[model samples]
Target: MGEPLATKHDVFQAIADPTRRKLLKLLAEEEMPVTVISGHFPMSRTAVSKHLRILSEAGLVRERRVGRENRFRLDPQPLQEIKQWYAYFERFWENKMAALQYLVESDEPVKPEQ
Candidate 1:
């Protein structure tokens, strides 16, 4: 393994709110200013800011103040923990499928159609 994944605090904080998840999806495409993020939600800028703050604390989003605007971007590395966890299930399912295939093939009779 490379480095340890993000702590529970990070993952929980990142996924605590639906707004944050939406923000993450948007940021995943490209970085945008606070205004752009607020445009997508019905909440106020302050509410969005709070969501962003939570995401930042979770190490999922990075914010930089450029002049008078705050630009927010996604930090995807933290999500690798989730991916790794899911990959474990993927392998388990794959092995089960292979075993099932072997069993089915082994039980098939090699009889010609008569």
Candidate 2:
């Protein structure tokens, strides 16, 4: 697959799950072992591992084997592509707001009533 298409798929997959999003937030703070991460949630360790696996496949997180534990860290570069995509819409909204402000100000007439 092409690079852009693959990156789009990765971002969609990464953001699809609330659990995964929470995991990403945790990893954003700092890399932590699976056990430590699992302690924050009520789900089983295996379920957390599955979420991590999906995130890893989506290129949102990276894992390393540290002795007997697996450590996961956020891979935020993929999110930069998502942010760049949103910036286009942000600019569009800004321009629309500017036009709306100009229209409202231009349409208002000064009141002469005492």
Candidate 3:
């Protein structure tokens, strides 16, 4: 099995914060300049910039300078790692839910055919 990801730049860490997650959602819709991205949140531009920096470090977003306009866009490739990691546990949840369903159905009395 692959080892767990444990680092500041891990995609999981990048998305852990609500602000960062919102930033990713915004960028996913369309690429935008840092100014526009910072506008979406109520926080100061500097705070948004910090969140962007973390997302950049995690490889979830890419930045480029276009004639003084620093634009950001979602990369999305890194998020696959996070999804794959969670899929393992999702199976466990599914099995538990299936068992609970069986118990509930069993508790209901059966009706005879007319």
Q: Which candidate has the highest lDDT of all?
A: 3
**lDDT of each candidate versus the true structure:** 0.79, 0.80, 0.83
Which lDDT tens digits does candidate 3 get at residues 21-65?
999999999989989999999999999999998899888888999
Task: Please identify which of the two predictions, 1 or 3, would achieve the higher lDDT against the true structure.
Answer: 3
The TM-scores of all predictions, comma-separated, are 0.70, 0.75, 0.78
RMSD in angstroms, all models?
A: 7.8, 7.2, 7.1
Off by over 4 Å in 3: 1-8, 102-114
Residue lDDT tens for model 2, 1-114: 434323324777678789889999999999999999999888999999988887887778888999998999998867877888899998876786575543334556634334
Give the CA lDDT, 0 to 100, for residue 60 in model 2. Answer: 84
Could you tell me the C-alpha RMSD of candidate 3 in Å? 7.1
Record all residue pairs in model 3 with backbone atoms less than 3 Å apart, i.e. clashing. Answer: none
